[model samples]
Target: MPKRIPLQRRGRAKPKFRPRTHKSLGKIELPKQENTGIILDLLHDNIKSAPIMKVRFGKDVMLLAATNGSRVGENIMIHKLADLPEGSLVCNVESRPGAGPKLIRSAGGAGRIVGKEGKLTSVLLPSKEIKKIHSECRAIVGRVAGAGMTEKPMLKAGAGFYAMKAKGIIWPRVRATKKNAVDHPFGGGGKTLGKKKTVSRHASPGRKVGSISARRTGKRRGKK
Candidate 1:
């Protein structure tokens, strides 16, 4: 006899929300510094001139917007760090309102504000597409969080395994259980029968639930 495939079982469900929220000291006022970093690249030109500045942080290159009084080869602290770029239009954002900076609504899609020009601002989209935006859109200034902010740790052997296990994100591998004739009394050797045993004779007639059988109930003849 050939070996039968084991049935799959359900596992424990994961929690929908995290218990603790990430907290920061909030926004602080600080003096603007001079631009002394290397020129990265221009984000937006013609439509709404805005540039993307790259500054050296240790060995890492931090990409920031060249906001007011900023230019290429200038070392200026990103006066504002928004959840997204200033003129960016976003939907389904995972941010608290009036908490930090919010994204603006974009005609094509979501983006981030990079630089400002009078009543207009520059925005960077997910596709790396840069464009101009209106200044009326609310924005916030701050340094971008360090790398690894979006990267999750991998579950590995030993301490990493136990840590993930405690978080309910990792668990032991389970083997499938064998099924027998008692579980499924059909030709197939498995728990659930390969085919339905109770074949309805009248199924072809298109009978439906809660429907009156005209033949059995009898219909009025000639409005009698």
Candidate 2:
């Protein structure tokens, strides 16, 4: 028998909201892209937004953006004594001379060299995880441009449709419970099965969905 793929069993893993008593606020806007007034060859037309400054390691390879005052053609190195460059979009900081960068690879992301202990350099990730890496590795400078891209709002359904279309995701998704039993696993909820929200890891395709292969369910109790 072939292995069964686990299915998710829930509407969504989102929090429920209570209606606001005060006047409802308008919709939220997306963020704005930071334009550094400079452009590079490969990064010009590919991504959602451009970086603040194009950071490069050597002749060929390119790195993330450098925000603040770290300009387009400045060089900074990682070491034990001095601090890292003040404002740069740094990512994949190497561990040692030969070790490649392995951390902080996102927009508006940068690593702080917390301290050094022997051969290991403690780097604070964007997620607050402190990683110990080699001290000789280098980190680019700058917070990526366009960190505030989510501040802007579409304010229209058509805008959202185009956005989803650009990402190649299917819009207007209908729920399984809303479907007939013949169509989906959670179908026929009125008669088939609405109470059972969890299924085994190896459930057949027709009976999947819910908390498939769930180790545990129900309310979590707090320690008194």
Candidate 3:
């Protein structure tokens, strides 16, 4: 009969492993929403005032509200909030949003919609002027707000308050300044290096405690 051999235990059993998944990492995805409410209001107001509008050149018009009624190839006015009636066309606009109007053809600045006619949309720009825009170019309704001014800055006070609580650090008053040498070297004032006195010359042994000597190592044995 063969001798019964004992099973030798090898290394400790490995723990069951799980591959990391993005779901476990706690990342979240958010859906984008259309920001057209203001545009819709402007269009509704425009249509209510005048269903049929004509755009001319050399006339100054103010956009009273935002809108979406005007299309490419259609004439429109730059009616101001103060003066809605008696608009001009000699200095008016001529191009629509979808139609490829030349940048030089814009009477006003880029993104400005003109409301007059017969006036040359393109101007003889000075040599210093780098941009070439068309006067006839009309921007889509609700598209004329200046850069980033329409959107509100996100409120971070709530998150910041919670973070400060967790870190056990009080939010200091806005005007408070640091006291004395505890501040970093780049900090203000003649408080440079503060009350701590400089070390005297040849105080400690060379390369010993607190010395600025170069590092040296003893010769190794039998390595020549």
Candidate 4:
């Protein structure tokens, strides 16, 4: 009998394939109302690379993604994007008016305010995509902290594995060719994939490993 494919095993959501959510400190979100808060503490979460700031607003407390130059005891203002001036750098931006922070939460990431038009504001994202978001949507000022985290090398396989483990990612990825014929579609073909690697966009998960719905394959030939 053939062993269960990696796709099937992962889809089963077993402990080995599940994200280690127990390690997460808490969800980071903007408060419902605009309020000034003082940072009570800076914390590290096992699942997040960015430092989290615990802030207290009056009697209520909330967690936010720490920004560069942020410090405990510092008073931070939570305001709508429309209230902030143009050319300001921001992070943890809400995609909609009441949506809590759906973008720019990655460590060292920030979105620049290009300009505002009517009820929408344009932001230049870290990926260089210009997205128009609702002006009333809120965000934290400044770039996300933990910059240069990637610049530091792991220097060891164990260190890399532990890092990926914290993020609930499977490390030491196995190539399809290294798998048995029953495991992957491109398996048991030595170095060469016996069949065309490109797959249909509607291919099932078990057979969707390679370049899906590729427009064209092979190296481009210049005008000869």
Q: What is the C-alpha RMSD, rounded to one decimal, of candidate 4?
A: 3.1
Q: Which regions of candidate 2 are displaced past 4 Å? A: 1-92, 95-102, 162-183, 188-193, 222-224
- Worst 10-residue lDDT window for candidate 2 reads 27-36
* lDDT (Cα, tens digit) per residue for candidate 2, span 16-108: 221222321221111122212232322322223334333333333334443434544455443321244322234546555444444554455
What is the lDDT for 107 in model 3? 18
Q: Regarding lDDT, does 3 or 4 come out ahead?
A: 4
Per TM-score, the best of the predicted structures is 4
TM-score of each: 0.25, 0.58, 0.18, 0.87
Alpha-carbon RMSD to native, per candidate: 16.8, 12.0, 23.3, 3.1
Q: What is the lDDT of candidate 3?
A: 0.27
The 10-residue segment with the lowest total lDDT in model 4: 1-10
| lDDT per residue (tens digit) for residues 1-224 in model 4 | 65667877888777887668898988888778756899999999888878999999887888888999998889998778899889999998999977788899888999999999999999999999999999999888899999898999999999999788766578989998888899898899688889988999998777887898999888889994
Model 2 has how many clashing residue pairs?
23
| Per-residue lDDT value at 35 in model 1 | 21
Alpha-carbon deviation at 176 in model 3, angstroms:
14
Which residue runs of candidate 1 sit more than 4 Å off their true CA positions?
Answer: 1-100, 103-120, 125-134, 148-224
